[model samples]
Target: MNHDAYPDNYIRGILNSVKSIAMVGASPVNVRPSYFAFKYLAQRGYDMIPVNPGHVGKDLLGKPFVASLRDIGRPLDMIDIFRNSSHIMPVVEEALTLDPLPKVIWMQLGARDDAAAAKAEAAGIKVVMNRCPKIEYGRLSSEISWMGVNSRTLSSKRPPAPTQGMRLSINRMSVGGGDTAASDRAAKNKSEQS
Candidate 1:
């Protein structure tokens, strides 16, 4: 997968496959991006765990924080790193030692380490860099577009009425989704038209 660009399907697949996520560098403050992302994924029904050594005893959105990845005490589908780029490798190394390795190592927006990503990929793990799962989830589900954001997907209709209130699946609108260049073109066109 390209570190600079991601196809919608790649993101959708991760989001759909990941039932549990370990959010490294999660924050107690509600205003932080980590807090918001954790809350959003948790609300979306993903089993979200917060990993922050400084706040191990604290809770974020009802989930108690763990000091490190090993403390999770359960298998994880993904590890969403919110730490700075320089700190990614240590986290990835620690993740590699887990018994049932995580399926994905996702570096958050503005937080990417090419070497760490390569290491994870070498271990047959999927890697995502410089992206936010929260944003991707919203974009793929057309939830963000409801707020007038360009989701890079074209659709003439809305998804079926939710069985649950305001809940959306990653499969909402998949048009122009899998091709990175194509999706960029669509977004560019939509932006230019606006």
Candidate 2:
């Protein structure tokens, strides 16, 4: 498949066929898109493994995080990458070294490395560039917000929304004083419940 243009059918096939995904550069911070996307995929019943040197040995959503693909020590169906274009080559090289190479190499939106993608494609590995698997899965499955209305069905009880004071707390927390605001929120939630 062309690295620049993957047919929709091919992309859909990969999404439907794969069971487990190793997410490289996944961050623990909930604010990051990588974290949200990874969390979303995991919640949707896909086996999502986080690979990040910084968080190696830590657990994200109960799945153990490994530092690199070589250390994962198991079969992976795909590697959904969140690293920069310049950093992708090494990851691809590592993936190639696996005894049974992964079926797909997915580069996140605005995260394409053409040369690296081509190398993987040359090895018979499917390449998906400049796209996010979470978005694609949700779109193709119609599991959530199919109309872009931000309304999605809940599998369980929905969580509370951020308070209106969330914005003020966000600004204050950026400068390192947000714990106090968070405490206030906890009290507010407790009071409202009572």
Which candidate gets the maximum TM-score versus the true structure?
Answer: 1
lDDT of 1 by residue, 1-194 (tens): 66656767788888888899999999989899999999888888889899999997779878899999999999999999999989999999999999899999999987777788899999999998778998998888877877877777766775677654355766755655444676545644553454
Collision count for each candidate, in order: 0, 0
Candidate 2 lDDT over residue span 110-140, tens digit each: 6767789889988999898777887766544
Point out the worst 10-residue segment of candidate 1 by lDDT: 183-192
Compared with the true structure, the alpha-carbon lDDT of candidate 1 equals 0.85
User: By lDDT, who's the top model here?
Assistant: 1
State the TM-score for model 1.
Answer: 0.86
The pairs that clash in candidate 2 are none
**C-alpha lDDT score of every prediction, in listed order:** 0.85, 0.74
